[model samples]
Target: MRLNHKYFSNLNNIANSSPQGIMKVSILESITNGFHLCCRSFEPVASAHILKELDELKTKTKKTIIEDVEKVKRLESEDRNALNRAVGIWKAGRDAPHKDAKFATDASI
Candidate 1:
């Protein structure tokens, strides 16, 4: 069965609503299409504009990540080093002192 324009348009709406959500959907679609082709011999073709939008979405996602990292770094430098250190230690398998500390800090500013 062919996916109609309405379906893709809905996907575009969803993609525009949230970048992370769009990335997840894109990854899932890619995997599903790959499996469909590999196991069922169904050839899936994406439209050029959809591919272009996906590319733009990826670029925007990377830019957002970079900006977030910069903000995190700024937080780390401005007397929030303790929170950063806590995050690092927690990431390395240690129990964090306060689980919501990072979120709290982020929300504060």
Candidate 2:
């Protein structure tokens, strides 16, 4: 457990050492208590050009999560058949915006 924390801290410090560094990394573990040992580790490394691909992936992931939550909300508030029809229409191109469509995005979503 001590070793895990040491490594995680080292990695985080190195990743954020640069004056203009923006990347973030984290590792969480609680096996010594009840969580888990280094169970969830998020380490992302990329070059200048690969950053664009990472951004695109992040956008897609956010969109998917948003749509999934919306679908759950709609299911809870509206009829299943109606939701299905709306999805079908959306899928069939009813001149609606794409689910993963990009819009002006800022930190304040």
Candidate 3:
């Protein structure tokens, strides 16, 4: 697959000079390069799964951003109850840190 010179040139400009930084940047560039290759390579036999996943990601991202904006607006509009509920939920998650950790460890085991 051919790499895009323009993309690599942009990456090159932003990339740090350190070996690890360069390697990290090159890996990202390779993925960006690979995306074009994959589209071309898989065009003939592409499944609906890829489109479905992309759509799902788009939907979830939009929903998350919209909800965040709504939450901010609610807070700004002096909706103390809604703000308190949101804070309570956030704090509950933080208070249950060990629950998530144990669940992850249990799943791995």
Best by TM-score: 1
| Candidate 3 residue runs with Cα over 4 Å from true position | 1-47, 79-109
Report lDDT per candidate. Answer: 0.67, 0.63, 0.70
lDDT of each residue in 6-102, candidate 3, tens digit only: 9777767667665567545656655766653344444533456688888999999999999999999877778777788999999998887564454
lDDT of 1 by residue, 48-108 (tens): 6588899999999999999999998887687577878788977976554666556545856
Model 2 lDDT tens row, 1-109:
3456777676667757865444333322343345443343322333554888889999999999999999998887778787888999888896776677666784545
Per-model TM values vs. the true structure:
0.32, 0.30, 0.31
Q: Alpha carbon lDDT of residue 108, candidate 1? A: 68
lDDT, candidate 2, equals: 0.63
Against the correct fold, how does model 1 do in TM-score? Answer: 0.32
**Cα lDDT of model 3 overall?**
0.70
Between candidates 1 and 3, the one scoring higher on lDDT is 3
RMSD for each of the candidates: 23.9, 26.0, 26.3
Which of the numbered candidates is closest to the native, going by highest lDDT? 3
